[model samples]
Target: DLAVLKSKFRGALVGSLLGDCLGAPFEGELVSSGDKIVIQKYFDKLESPDLKGPIRSYTDDTAMMKSVAKTFIDKPEVDYTYMAKLFVKEYFAEPKRGYGESIVEVFSKLRKRKFEDVYKPAQEQFNGSGSFGNGGGMRVAPVALYFYNNYDAMIDVAKKSTQLTHTHSLGVHGAVFQCIAVSQALACNPKKKIDPEQFCNELKQKMKEVEKENDDGLNLKVEQPYVDKINVIQHFLKAKYNDELDEEIGIVLGNNICAIESVPTALYCFLRSLEEIPTVKTDNIFRRTIQYAITLGGDTDTIACMAGGIAGAYLGEEAINRNMAKQCESYEKTIEMADSLYNAVCGASNRA
Candidate 1:
């Protein structure tokens, strides 16, 4: 059981890394399902023995995620200022990661004026309206992993961390939604059967608890728009659409970088594709899920990263393609980080 749990923790982070790297090249490409064949072929080549060097690279999504994990490892408590500094520092250390422009503004503001209050710059964005972009959700898996045993604290910290850069209701909720999803994935027993209905119900309830609070001008009120998206997610999965499901989901949910659209889309991809590995049918279920997410196009890396996080939590490290995993940039470093987080989680469990 501990082995399975360890594999899952490693899987969540490593899977996120692979998805980001594999999907990086197609980040901005507007691909169609027609490209499914090409995508499959692209992944097929990863099995070749002659393949050399890293197969793909990661972008800002994975970069920020590392910061979140490191922040937790260094400081187990939810210190917004310390975590925010990690994010800002990471962006400045390597600006070429292609962080979203709005986030860059927030990072730049943080750098320009060193404020004792780390959240001030982000709260002041959009003429004080704040950014609703998906930057917050993109990097929140670590929060889920770090606070796996503490859902209440996870919700609170997730919201605070997101608002550090994205203060809009949708933005804030997006990170919380993703955090809850990852936390559930990590909590699951990989050896047991996964109940889709029960899974959705439990997460939906957690979300309801998360949202059913008073908003003291903090944009934290539980609203229907994001929940409606989750509802749509449940609805689509239940109906189990025909050949038109992918396109329908794209049209209905979208796959852009905005946390509202992309986060749910990623969740839908992971949940729906778990039954069968779409066109490719790769041996590794985790890779298959990531590839399936990539075929949907439109912010492939982020969607794949988010989906990969959930899938990894469910499938564990064995589900990842060994060749593909080996070729990812910073594969060793990523593995080390996963183990670090896993050990930290285990330590917490022992203490409890």
Candidate 2:
């Protein structure tokens, strides 16, 4: 049983890294089926033993993901400020990782020791409205995996961890939703078939409770408001993906960096890719998950990274493309960190 969970634990992290690394090159391009083929061809090229030149590099997605993983590894209970320090540490170690604009200010403010408040800058962003970007969601898988046994802890800890860099309820809710998705996925019996219908409904119910508690002025009457977005994902999951489906999903579900738009969309991509989609030819569900997410085009790296984390939790490393994974910077290191995180969780479980 531990072995299965371990594989899934590793899968969740590795999937996040692979998606980030592979999806980084085409981050902002508006891609089509033709563009999807180009991405598929790039993967085909990875099968070669002697590949030449710059492999696609991971951006802030993988960097902060590692921070989150390291946070879980270093502190079993997940200290918010300590986790924030990891984010600050990673940015200063290598500033050229193509971090998003708003996050850079968060990093700089954290670096100065004069101010003891680590979360002040983030709360002050957008003229005190704060950033609602998916930065919090992108790096939250580790939190889910670490707290898989305790849903209440997972929700509270996810919020605290997210608030380290993103204080807005939009940013915080995305992390909460993503963490629960990953947590639920990890708890699933690897041997049992997943019911997409039941899975999405459970998430929506839980998120409904969360959103109702923390009303961020997002009117409940709005169609597909936060919790309702998960319902939309359930809609796409039951249908086969087509050209029209692609366009509609991009419009309604979205594929951008905002936590509001991208988080639920990533969940949709993972769930929909689990079944056969005749339009995309790839049979590797993991690859299909990332491919389909990227095809949507906006915020490719972060969306793929998020989708990959979900799919990986269900599919494990066996579904991943190793050659493609190896192309990413710090590939082995991330994998090792994943394994280490697994050990930490298992050790905690044993103690409990």
Candidate 2, backbone clash total: 0
Worst 10 residues of 1 by lDDT: 343-352
Model 1 per-residue lDDT tens digits across residues 232-334? 8888888844657877877798888888789988888888776774575676667777898888888889999988999898888888878888878877888
Candidate 2 local lDDT, 163-210, one digit each (tens): 878888889999899999998888877667789899988988898888
lDDT of each: 0.81, 0.83
On the 0 to 100 scale, the lDDT of residue 155 in model 1 is: 84
C-alpha lDDT of residue 142 in model 1: 78
The best candidate in terms of TM-score: 2
lDDT of 1 at 126: 87
- In terms of lDDT, the best-performing candidate is 2
| Cα error of candidate 1 at position 174, Å | 0.7
